[model samples]
Target: IRDFPTLMTKARICDEDGKAKSSYYKAMNDKKGKGLDRGKPYENKGNGN
Candidate 1:
């Protein structure tokens, strides 16, 4: 689980859900660096893609 301070930090950095999604996709698509893989799909269980 994530720590409360970390969650608070993210909340401060990403003011809206759209900003958070943008940051997430940017990190995932990064290459020649610490990019994450497009791993197995799972139930979103929440709004948006």
Candidate 2:
């Protein structure tokens, strides 16, 4: 849910339901967990792409 606003914005642009989707997901499952270590950027070929 960290990217909720951005997800909603993108969903609005694409005419999708991001918030409802995330809510449904959260409803069906627990949000607590070890989670991922996001200290580093999720790079994709960097600037050289």
Candidate 3:
């Protein structure tokens, strides 16, 4: 039962612009779960860092 809501929320996050939200990144950072490094997805690509 509890899993259903989490599943739905995750689906919604993925649906938004086909990218995970900042909250998703934060949660992943805290729990070491699913998501890229913090700020990785939003980093300045001009630096190539």
C-alpha TM-scores of all predictions: 0.32, 0.30, 0.31
What would the per-residue lDDT of candidate 3 be over residues 1-49, giving only the tens digit for each residue?
Answer: 3689989988887788465576687777888744464565556878876
Candidate 1: list runs displaced more than 4 Å: 1-15, 31-49
Q: Which number leads on TM-score?
A: 1
Clashing pairs in 3: none
lDDT of 1 by residue, 1-49 (tens): 2699989878777678878898889877874454366543565746476
RMSD (Cα, Å) for all candidates, in order, is: 16.5, 16.9, 13.5
The numbered model that scores best in lDDT is: 1
The weakest ten consecutive residues by lDDT in model 2 span: 31-40
lDDT tens digits, residues 1-49, model 2? 4689988877686655667787889976774553575444557556775
Model 3 misplaced stretches (Cα beyond 4 Å): 19-49
lDDT of each: 0.72, 0.68, 0.71
Candidate number with the higher TM-score (2 or 3): 3
Error of 2 at 42 (Å): 37
Name the candidate, 1 or 3, with the larger lDDT value.
1
